[model samples]
Target: MGRRILLTCGEPAGVGPELAVKALGCGVDFAWIGDPRHLPAGTPVAQITAPDAQVPPGHLPVIRHDFAADATPGQPNPVNAQGVIDVIARAVDLVGRGDFAAMTTAPINKQALKEGAGFAFPGHTEFLAHLAGNVAVAMMLASTNVSPACRVVPATIHIPLEQVPAALSDEVLEQAIRITHAALIRDFGVAAPRIAVAGLNPHAGEGGTMGRQEADRMRPLLDRLRAQGLDITGPLPADTMFHAPARAGWDAAVCAYHDQALIPIKTLDFAGGVNVTLGLPFVRTSPDHGTALDIAGQGRADPESTIAALRMARDMAALRA
Candidate 1:
C-alpha cells in the first residue's frame, strides 16, 4: 500500500485552510493535518485521530494540530509559525512510517516561518530533504490538466540569475536528470523517459555565439547520458522548446534555472499545476502556487492546484504500489 494521503495545511494565515475546505469532496479521500480553527467558520469538518481513521461523510477529515492563536483572515501571526512547521513534520513522520500514502502540502510563507521559528531552508523542498536525512530531491512543476502533462525541473532553483551560471554545474545537472529519470519510471510508470534540456543562453549558445555554457558545459554531459542509452535532446533554444509540438517530443524538460522551467508551466496551466518533489523516499507533492495572504479567508482561493495535487498523489501512489 502507498498509504493514505495526508494534507499538511501550510500557513494558516493564508489560503491553505480555505483550499483544504474546498477540497472536501474533490473526488479524493485524505486527512487534513492542521488546526481546525484555521478553517473557515462553519466549514464541515470531521476530526480524526489518525490517517486511517474513519471519516464522516460530507466532511473534511482533520487530524487537528493546534495553533498558538486563532488565525486572522490575512494577517499572519508569527505565533502560529511553529504550528505551521509542525504540521509538515507530522505529515512527514506519518508518511515516512508508511502510515500515509503521500503528503500534499499547501503553500507556506518562508518569511513568516523564519521570523517565527528561526526556520532555515529556502522552502518545503529543502526542508523536507533535511527532515528525510538530507536526501537529495528535485522540484518538478507538472500541469495536471494538460494531456500528457507538461512537466519540468529547474536544474538550479531558488538562486539569483547572476548566480545561476556558477551554480549550474555538471553534477547538479546530472543529479536533476538522474532523479527526474528515476521518478518518471518509479512514480510515473514511464518505461523510457525522453527528456529535453534547455540551454543556458539564447539559442543554445548558437554554436558558442550566444554563450559557451551550452556548448562547453552542457553538451558533453548530455553526450555521456546518451552514450549510456538515455534519450536526451539538449542545448536547445529555450525560446522554442515549450510549444505544444515541441513539448510533445519529451516526457519532461530540464532547464538551467528556475524561471526557464516554471514560467511556461505556470503560464500554461496557472491553476492546475502540481509542484512535485522527486527523489524522496516517499511520494510528496504540493500546490504550485504560494501562500496567498491577501486572499486568505475570502473563500476565494482556487482549489484546482490542491485538488490536482491530491489526484496526482493518488496516481503516483498506485504507480509506486
Candidate 2:
C-alpha cells in the first residue's frame, strides 16, 4: 500500500485534467505527471519530487513536467503534444525502476501527437510495448462486482473491418489468449480461469457457411490449447457469448475483433470500465473511454472510469505483491 501509483494527465485540451483533479479524493494514493498550471485555477495541488510524496486531503499530489504552452480546454494545441508524450515516457521509466506500484493513464490525442512529434505507434498499448522492449501485450477491458462481471480481450484491434480477416492469424490470437490467461491468474487472482472465446463469423461461421476461419483456424487452435490443460471454450457464436448466463460461465472472453469485445463491457459498465494491459512487466490501466474534447472545461466529463482504473491498478498491484 505504500508503493506509489502514477497518473499521467493525458491531452491537456481534453477532459484529462478535469478528471485528474476530480480523482483526487478517490482514496487511491497517486501522483500526477503533468504541468500544475494545466489544473483548474482553484484546484488544490502539492508539487512532489518523489513518487511516494504525501499530500493533504483534498489536494492532488503532482510531479510537474511543465508543458511548452498554456492549454486551452476544448482546443488542442500541437505545441504541448511533446510534453504529453514526455510525461508518459517518464512515468514508464519510473515504473520500470520500481518507483511506482502501477500507472493508470489518462486519454491522449493520437492525431495531435502525430502532428507534433511524428509519433509512429497506433496508440498507448503499442507505445508501452515499444518502451518495454517489444514485449507481447494484449488489451483487456474489465468490470468487476457487477452483474455479468467479465473481462474481454480483442484479438484484432484498431483496424478496419475489411482488414480484420487478413490481420488475424493463429499466432496473434494465441498470444492474446495466453497473455489474458496468465493475467487472469496473476493479476485478478483467479485460480482456474474459464475463457469463452467468440467466433469471427455469424453463428460461429454456421459450420463453415458464413466463414471458414472459425472451423479452419480458430477451432483447431482452441483445441490445441485445451489439450495443453487450458480451460478454453470457444469459437462460440459472438451473439450468445455475452449474455448473463453465458458470461457467468467464464472469467474472460476473447473476441475475434475490437467491437465484439468492447461493446458488452461498455454497455454494462460504461462509466466504471477499465482498460488493462496484460503481459507488461508492471501493472498499467486506463479509463475505458477517451478524452472528451468538447466537455473538457465544462466539468461534464465523468471521472468514474478514471477512478475505476486507479482502483483496479491498486488492486492488481496488491495481488502481484
Candidate 3:
C-alpha cells in the first residue's frame, strides 16, 4: 500500500473526466476529486468518505465537489467555471495540509475558467504558484520510457516570442537552473544531476554571430553555477542537444524558451509526458497536454499522460518522503 494521492479532474467540458475514469483502470493508487454526476453515466465510481477509502476493482474513488451545473461534454459552460477553479483550490489545500501525498491534475481550460469565474492568473502554473504562497516555480516536462528519457525546463514560459529576448536574463536563467538542479537532487533522487542549458540563439550564438545571449547572459550564469559545485553544462545549441547521443550527456536540459524544451519531449513521448512543477513546497504534476475539446465525451481521450503523471507523482513523493 502506497500513500493516497489526490487527483483533480480538470475541465468537465473537455476529456478530463473521461481520462480520469480511464486512469482508474491503470492501477495508480489515488482518489479523484470532482463531481460524481459529472462522470459519464456508466462509469464505476465509489464516493470516498475517508482518505483511505477502499476502491473496488474497476471503480474510481472520488471525493465529490458538486459543480454548479451539470457539465455538458464538448460544451464548456461558464457557469461551471467557478466550480472547476474550486476543485483545484481544494486539491492544493489538501496537499498543503498533508491530507494527501501529492497531487496530479488534469488539463484545465483556461479560457473557460476566465470567462466563467473571472480567474486572474495566466494558467495552472501561475495559479498554483499563487496558492503556494507565491513561490518561484519552474515547469519541467519529463518522460521515463522514451529512449534517453529527458527532462526539460523552459527558462521563459508563456511569453511572447518578441518579448523573449528581454524576458530572458541572467537572473531568470539562474533561477530556473537553480530550482531545476535542486529538484533533480531532491525529488528525482539524482545524487549529482547533470544539467545542460540551451542557448537562445542558433549554434549557441556561434560566438556572437547569431545572438549575444549565449556569450553575454547564459555563459556567465553557467560559470557561476559551476563555481557552486553544480554539474551544469551549456548554453549549448538547442538543435543538437536533444538527440540520443547528446541527451545521454545530461540528466536534464534547461532551454531558453517554451518551444525549445517542449517540442522535443512532445515529439518523443507526447502521450506519456508528465508536466512537473518544480520549487513548490509540495509535489505537483499534470498531464503534459491540454483539454482535447474535440474528443471530450467520445471516450476517445487517452489517459496515458494522466496515468504517467500519477505514477510520476507517486515516484517523486516516495523519493521526497
Candidate 4:
C-alpha cells in the first residue's frame, strides 16, 4: 500500500497552493493541509463525497483550513501568519499521532510569520524542534548526481558570527555527528556511511595560522568517533571540501557553519534542493527555497523544489514504514 503523505502548504500567498495542485495532478495519494479556498476556483479536488467515497484520479484531497485574509501574489500579509503556523501545527500533529505516514512542507516566510502572528524562531527546523518538545535536529540539503548534495549545521545556529567560537563545543559536535550518523543508517539506508567534517576556519586553520577551532575542538571529536569505528574523516578545509572530486568520496559532508554547507548545494541546484530534517522521530521534508511572495500568484512559480520535496517525503515514508 502507498503511504498517506500530508503536505502542508505553508504560506498561502506563496507557491504552496500551486505546487499542491501540480503534485495532485501527477496522481500522488497525498492530502493538502491548508485552505481549499486558497486554491484557484474550479480546481479539481479529490474530496470524498461520503465517508467511504472512493478517491479518483486527477483530484486532490484537501483538508481545508481557511485563511483570515486574502493573499496576493508578490505581496505578504502578516495577518495571515497564524494561518501558516496553524497548517504546519496540524500536519505535525497528524504525523505525530500517526494519522499520516509522512509530511512534505511548502516554504514559509519567517519574517511574515513573526510580524503577522508573533512566531518566534529563525525557521522551520527550529520551530519543528520546539513543536516536537525541543528535540535536537540537523538540516540536510540533498540532490541527485546532476546537482551537489550537502548536509549542514553550525555547532551553533542562529547566533551571531562572533559568538561561534564560544559556541563550538566538543559536546555539540559529537551530538551532531551522532544525529547525522543515525540519519545515514536509518533514513538514507546507507549500510556504512562515510561522513566528512569541515573545519571552522579558512584552510582548516592553516595549522593554527587561520584559527585553532579545528585542532582544539573539532579534531578531538572526529578522532573519538573514528575510534568508535565510524566511517568518518576530516577537519578538512571547508573551501576545498565541496567540489565534485571531494564529495564523490563521501556519503555526506558536515560543515562547521550554515553557509559553509548551504552555499554549495544551493548554488548547484537552487530549483530542486530538498531540505531534510535529520533526527526527527517522524519523517519531515521540505523544499530548500522560501516563499517567494514577489511571484506567489503570478503563476510563474517553479514547482521543481516542491516536487523534489514530495518525492523525498514519499520515499522516506516508505523507508520508515
Candidate 5:
C-alpha cells in the first residue's frame, strides 16, 4: 500500500482549510483532519466521509472535529483553541500508531491557540515534541532551487536575543549538528552532507574581538563533530555565509539563532520554503509561512508554500517507507 499522509488544517478561522482543499486538488493520497463544515458546502470531493477518510478525487477526505462556532476569515476565536490542538494530537496519534505514514500541518495562530486554548508551547515544533513524549527535535527550513539548497537550524529558538549567549552550549550545538546531518542523509537523501555552522557574533567574533562564543562555544563542537567523521565547517561569518559563493559549498547551514538562519531563506524563497522537523520518528513537515489571518478568507491565500510542504512531506514519507 502507498504511504498515507495526514493533512491537519490548523486554526479554522485561518487559511488551513483552504490550503487543505487546494492540496487535495493536486491528487495526493492524504486525509484532512479538521471540521468538515469549514469546507465549502457541497464541494464535489471524495472524502473518507468520517474521521479517517480515504483520499477521493475532486473531493476531500475529512476527519471531522466539529468546532463550537463557525470560522470567519481574518477573525480568530480563542474558544476553538482546543480544537486546533485536538487536530494536531490526533494526527500525531494516527502517525504514531502506524495508521498514517506522515503528517503535513497547516499554519496555526499561536496567540489564538494560547489565549483560547491555553496551549503552553510557543509553536508547533515544541508542542509536537510534547505530544510525542518530549522527543528532542529541531526545526529546519529548506529550499531546493536556491543555489546550494539551504537547510537551517537555530541553536536557540523563539527566545530573546540577549538569552542566546547564555543558551549557547557545546551539547546543544552538537545535538543540532548531529540531527541536521542525519536529516540531510535520511530526509533529503544527501549521501555526504556538507554543513556550515554560522558564528554567533559579527565577523565570527572578529577572532574574539567581538565575542568569544564562536571560539569558546561553537569551535569545540564543530571540532568534535569533525573528529566523528562528519563533513562540517564553520564559525564562519554570518553576513557572508548565505550568499551564492558561500552557499555553494554546503548542503545545510546551522546558525546560532532563529533570525540569523531564517531571514536569508525567507528572503531567498519565502513563498516556496518548507519547514521540516528533524529527529522525529515519523516524517512531519509544514509550510514555512504562517496562517495568513489577514487574508484568511479573501480567497487570496497563496497555496505555493503549502504545495511545497505537501511535496516535501510526500518525499520524506517515501524515504522513510
Candidate 6:
C-alpha cells in the first residue's frame, strides 16, 4: 500500500461516516476502517479483504470493523463504545505493521467512550500513545491552509488550568520540544526546525516579577537544549506568538497548556486544522475538532478538517516513505 492512509471511524453515531464519504475523491489513497452499515444511507461502500485492494471510484473502501449496534444520528450508543475503541486499536495495529503509510482518525467522544467502554485516557493522542506501546508523544495541531502555516504543541494537556504549573516540569517541556522538533524534520520536511516555547504565566512571568518558572526553570532547560544544536527560542509571551510576522520566526510553537496552543490555531484555521501526534512509530492524525453530536448526520458537518487530515497524512506518509 503506497502512501495509503487508514481512516478510523470515530464516534459512528456522529459525523465520522459522513466525513469518510466526503473524504473520498480528494486524491488521497485511503481505506475506511469501520462497519459500512454505520455509514450514511445510500453510501456506495465496497469491502476489501486486504488494505492494498482497490475500490471503484465513488465507492468507500471499508475494512469492516463491525459495531455491536446500529448508529442513531445525534445520539451515541454506549454499547457501541467498545467497537470505537477497538477500531482505533485495530487501525494502530495495522498501520504499525507498515501496511499503511499513515492513519487519519475521525473524532471520538471521550465521555461516551468512558461511559461505554470504561475508557481511561484523556483523548485520542494519549490513547494512541498507549496503543503504540507507551511511547512518548506530542500532540501537534497543524493548519497548512494558513499562510506561514501554524503548528502548535501543548506540553501539558487535558488538565485543570490551575494544575498546569505543577504539571509542566523540565522533563515534560523538553520531551515536547524534542518530539515536535523531530517531527518537523521527519514528517514536515523541515531540515532544521525552529521551535518557540510559550511561557506558562502572564508576560512570561514578567521577567520573574510575576512567576519564576520562566527564568528559573524554563530558561535553563532551553539553554541546555540549544547548546545541543537545536534551533529553539522562548519562554515567549503567549499573546505575542501567533501574528504572521511572529509565526514566521518559528517552525513550531510549544505552549504550556492546551488552551494556550489550541485557541490561536483554532481561531486561525478552525475549519482546516489537523491534530497530529508526533514521535509515534507510525504517522497519526485526526480532525482538530471533536465528534459533532449536535449536527451528526444532517450533512451540515464541515469536512474540511477531515479532508485536510487525510491529505496531510498522505503527504507526511510520502515524506516518511
Span of ten consecutive residues with least summed lDDT in model 5: 48-57
Give the worst 10-residue stretch by lDDT in candidate 4.
46-55
Top-lDDT structure, candidate number:
6
For residues 1-321, what per-residue lDDT tens digits would candidate 4 score against the true structure?
335778897888888888788676544467887877777667787654222235676777877778898777667788889999988988888788777788889889888888988899988988998888899998888874243355554445667778777776887778877888888888878789899988888999989998988888788889988999988889999888777787777888877777777888888778878888888888899988888877777678787787788778878777888
Clashes of 6: 0
C-alpha-based local distance difference test score of model 4: 0.79
lDDT of each: 0.91, 0.91, 0.90, 0.79, 0.84, 0.93
Q: Write the per-residue lDDT of candidate 3 for residues 170-236, one digit (tens) a residue.
A: 8899999999999999999999999999999999999999988889888988998899999988889
Instruction: List the candidates' TM-scores in order.
Output: 0.98, 0.98, 0.98, 0.93, 0.95, 0.98
Name model 2 segments beyond 4 Å from true: none
Which portions of model 4 show Cα errors greater than 4 Å?
Answer: 48-53, 145-155
Q: 124 in model 4: Cα distance from truth in Å?
A: 0.7
Say which prediction, candidate 1 or candidate 6, comes out ahead on lDDT.
6
lDDT of 6: 0.93
lDDT of 1 by residue, 1-321 (tens): 435689998988889988988888888889899889888899788898766878768888889888899989788899999998999998899899888888899999999999999999999999999889999899999997776679999999998899999999999999999999999999999899999999999999999988899888899999999999999998789999998889889999999999999999999999999999999988899999989988888778899999999999989988887
lDDT for each residue of candidate 2 in 1-321, tens digit (9 for 90 to 100): 348789999999999998998887788888888998888889998998877876787888898899999999988898999999999999999888888999999999999999998889999999999999999999999985467687899989988999999888999999999999999999999999899989999999999999999999999999999999999998899988887899989999999899999998888888889999999998999999887897889989898999999999999999998
TM-score of 6: 0.98
Clashing pairs in 5: 45-58, 45-59, 46-59, 47-60, 47-61, 48-53, 48-61
Taking the tens digit of each residue's C-alpha lDDT, what string does model 6 give over 30-80? 899998889999999889877788778889888998899999988999999
